[model samples]
Target chain A: MASMTMIPADCSSSTAATTRLLPMSCHKGKALHFSRWVSLSNRLTASSFPSLSFKARASSPLISAKIVIENAAKVIDGKEVAKQIRKEIAVEISRMKDAIGVVPGLAVILVGDRKDSATYVCNKKKACEAVGINSFEVHVPENSTEQELLDSISKFNEDPSVHGILVQLPLPSHMNEEKILNAVGIEKDVDGFHPLNIGRLAMRGREPLFVPCTPKGCIELLHRYGIEIKGKRAVVIGRSNIVGMPAALLLQREDATVTIVHSRTKNPEDIIKQADIVISAVGQANMVRGSWLKPGAVVIDVGINPVEDAESPRGYRLIGDVCYEEAIEVASAVTPVPGGVGPMTIAMLLSNTLSSAKRVHNFR
Target chain B: MASMTMIPADCSSSTAATTRLLPMSCHKGKALHFSRWVSLSNRLTASSFPSLSFKARASSPLISAKIVIENAAKVIDGKEVAKQIRKEIAVEISRMKDAIGVVPGLAVILVGDRKDSATYVCNKKKACEAVGINSFEVHVPENSTEQELLDSISKFNEDPSVHGILVQLPLPSHMNEEKILNAVGIEKDVDGFHPLNIGRLAMRGREPLFVPCTPKGCIELLHRYGIEIKGKRAVVIGRSNIVGMPAALLLQREDATVTIVHSRTKNPEDIIKQADIVISAVGQANMVRGSWLKPGAVVIDVGINPVEDAESPRGYRLIGDVCYEEAIEVASAVTPVPGGVGPMTIAMLLSNTLSSAKRVHNFR
Candidate 1:
């Protein structure tokens, strides 16, 4: 295993610090040598990495090579893992269809003209088709009443063909999100936003009918990678109901001692440094730095934050809550921003749909 | 303020370590000095207290004076607090009754003839009568069917006079606890064991109809004492559904950075040392020692474990999960075992009943 060594190089500019990596050994028949210019303002205190010192080497203008050995973190390819899951789901669906003459169905209800929501819904429909699951769609105008949306959910609840029902979020501000989400029958709540489902998830000895997709996807990645969770220290950044809170609960359920760091938390970096596993879902671009991680810690980044990018066609590029460049050198394993937890959300939704159908039909 | 100083004294016996306290300045015109014999086996490492060294002083047989200054933690008298709360609740109930001509009523169903359960039920009834709230009781044999219990719950659910219904736990092995708990109306779930209530408690911006009594009491003690919770580090030392789990959720809801330490947690003392507040619900007697706490931490001990005491009329006496003798010298404030969380549980139950009546009748 070839390791990368980071050496702090004296920089002429005071605002920026440069770190140079000298060629050491070959990995995959390729020599590595590079220099990185990091802004001093964004540099987190190196308290977590006590062995490595990045203090200014302004006294020595020449090569002041300080060997800071770093191991390249194994990249958790969510796209590939999600594809594997989809294939497994397809096999189950085909088998169930042959035995019971039934296929899982997912219903998507969209009430607004938002472009992003439309794109997400479209992708979900295509994913369903690829996995041999039937897809149902209903689009209502933004001016539609809450009663109309509730009626749609009620109709879907009565329809046995639709195993799962998901209403696109960020509904019209006038609509009561809780009321509308609660209206979805718990059995068909694939999105799993209902209070009853969440309650079950929080209670010990009780199982939720459906786990929320994003957090469930995060845990699935850990399991698929064969990471041990029991008796390990895990820290979850952000406490949003959708991702962070449920993710912490899931980790605790798996017997990992869990701590939740939120906006109100003080010295979060110190807490993050102690975790054997870290899951960040704060939706902040590159908020977690390499210095905040414990060496060999597994990191699951659920954030998909967009940063302004002049080179991109859309003038913006997506990044995770973790600084990828720094994390690759420190963590034992990490999930990439766009291709990591993002793809797994939809995949888990489909899995929930399939499970719901099987449960309803008493299929193994 | 008078401070206590602990000095390690050489003991003749190798198995036991003795700590002697020299007389310091008077507090309330009373001089305090004492010697305590602590078992070496139960001694936790003094890593949290770097300043204090408890290493064996076997070399010196006489008094080797090493003054370790310790602040005496204020004793939180739960019986007094509960009494004050009962008075406040009584005033509210009288005002509501005069304004709307309606009184709150609590109905309790006891399934078995367990002596402890009988005492608890009788105490609850007397508490309700003392506060001018109507109390209803149902006693059933151990051989009673689950349907019979469900029928009692159903009757209480439809009764306008009954604002809250409680089913004593540890029902006969034949009964399903979850089903019976779920049967209680959400609005009247004064015990707050219903998953829906717990789910609401876990979620942000959503309030449960009633918070679980014991955990609610713990938070109340903090609030009543004017202890700040926001942005503070809090540690909960268990994850039982009844107390520890709900306590952690409640602490998080109040914006305290929360960490849960369970049996699977490694080096629990290290984690507990970082908390500004600690709540321990594990039933093991004296599991948390002074060395496990950070100086000035506020501790709430919820365990009521019975230990042998030959001097008492009863062969056993109750103690808390924390080592009270050690905690009183280290913590800023602490709740005693019997006089602390025990009284607050019943008080919160009564409070929940009153709140239910006010909510159902639309009486502010």
Candidate 2:
């Protein structure tokens, strides 16, 4: 294990300026300085020590000593954790089928020919197959009417064999997205994009039948990695319906002191630096720099942006909202771009399908 | 005008201990002390300067000089503001009625005979009358079946003349609150307790046809006063589905960096002292004291609890979760008990009903 480098004394001078600008009289002697590691360490329990997420540190000689000395965050292994969840879902599905002689099923309605949409649909189908759940996909043409899409959703809603229904987003330009989503029966709304499900998610003591997959994946990663969310300060840097907003709501449900920093927010960097955990889904690659992060922050990056990479075989490579190179040094733990939330999304969809099946069939 | 009292130097020692206990290295040199008035004075605008809501100050010259010299918060006059909004609503209702031959109507379905519930319903009916919106009432016996209540809601849902429907909360234990609330049509859900409306409120860029009244009133208070929510740190002290949860969500929509402090939260006072604004809805009398407030912080007390008072004619008096005496000296602005959020809730309910009517009739 590498001995961690101490944070330089002048790292928090910018925050000192912000403190001066605040109207509250209590804004002095509490601006965060990286030099105060002693008090920080005292506040954390042994289980929550930043080094726990670094399981690959010993085996991966690719990790540089300089980065390691700079307090490299433990890499939250989302790929591995997602695989574990899929295995559990498979077992549950198998047990339910054996007990009731019925297999779980998912129905996907994808409109238009967007490359990204097709790829996502294909991935979902493959994932359902991997877990032995039946997949029913309806691919309407790009020029299809809203009525045609609603009819397909109606068919899935009425079919007892299909326990889950998902309408792929970025629907055709002419169609009303809300109308189409609301058309899906609440029981079959495994995508959890329906307003009712989201409402249930927002209310205390009320559980949504399904949580939106991507945000659920983010929380699942934290849970799988044994990170404590309750009482911790969390900053979510986006307010998108599918990811950022739901992510913030879910964090609040888990009792994290959650703050959302969107496009209109001022002093975002200053706010982000105060979080014990940071979830960035702003879709702007490398928007979160090293300075934006509090030292020892656990970061879950949900943004997957494509950046030009001439060296790669493909025309471009995916980069997350977080500046990985910069964040890895300051954070206590981080989830990588491609492998972090992406795999977990598919896993959650499968889990939702399994749960829906169990619920409908009473095969718990 | 009575002189405001100055806060003592040693008022925030507990916060100092909490500042020392934070795990984030960024927590340094920012502990609040009430003695610092000059910096606080520099941050406030003219309209927002303390004393605006202090309507009782002149009449009650008994308000001590020591307390007056201490920074007295700008009093947020919810009663006065609600009155102005009601007047505006009256004008709108008249114009709509004259043009469209239809008056906005609100239906209240009250179950049980609790004195408070009766008073609330009566007040609502009176408010509707004042605004020239027709009022319809349906009172069910406490022993009525869920079906009976549902039947009444269904009738109002189908009534074209009724633009809004509210089922008084704390329905008999035998009835399912969720089931009955869901029975009200989404369009008529002016109380904004419906899952769909709440979901819309939670989603970014999506608008709820109606927002929950209490929370809406809280936001309206801040807006009418020109208190900037965007980029400010706000602490909502509670997570009730009715008030605290939605209030936090609404504040987030306004781009405030919002943190919800609940029962499980650690060092709530310390967390609260950091906020530029604090909204307390925990229902505990005087739980939020002057020491818990950051000097120049804006306080919104949502809790309305009755404490036994031998001197009062009723032998009890209503109080807020915040200790008004202490907070008035520390905050930049504060909403007083009885006249604060109480008046605003009904104002918001009327506003919601009026908006729903206008939306339905295309009167706007």
Angstrom error of the Cα, residue B140, model 2: value is 1.6
Residue by residue across B36-95, what tens digits does model 2's lDDT show?
Answer: 332333233435454323343233444544345444566676777788789889998999
Backbone clashes, each candidate: 0, 26
Q: Model 1 off-target regions past 4 Å?
A: A1-70, B1-70
Residue B301 lDDT (model 2)? 89
Which CAPRI level is candidate 1? medium
Q: Summarize candidate 2's per-residue lDDT along A1-364 as a digit string, tens digits.
A: 0112222222123133211112222211111222143223322343544542334433344453433453456666566677778888889888887888999999998899988789889999999999999999999999988888889999999999999999988887899888898899999888889888999999977889989999999998788667889888899998888888889889989988887888877778887987888999877777787768877789999877776666669756776778766666668877777777878999999988888988887775
Quantify all predictions' global Cα lDDT against the true fold. 0.80, 0.78
Q: List model 1's recovered fraction of native interface contacts, to 2 decimals.
A: 0.76
- Candidate No. with top lDDT: 1
Residue-level error in angstroms, candidate 2, position B188: 1.6
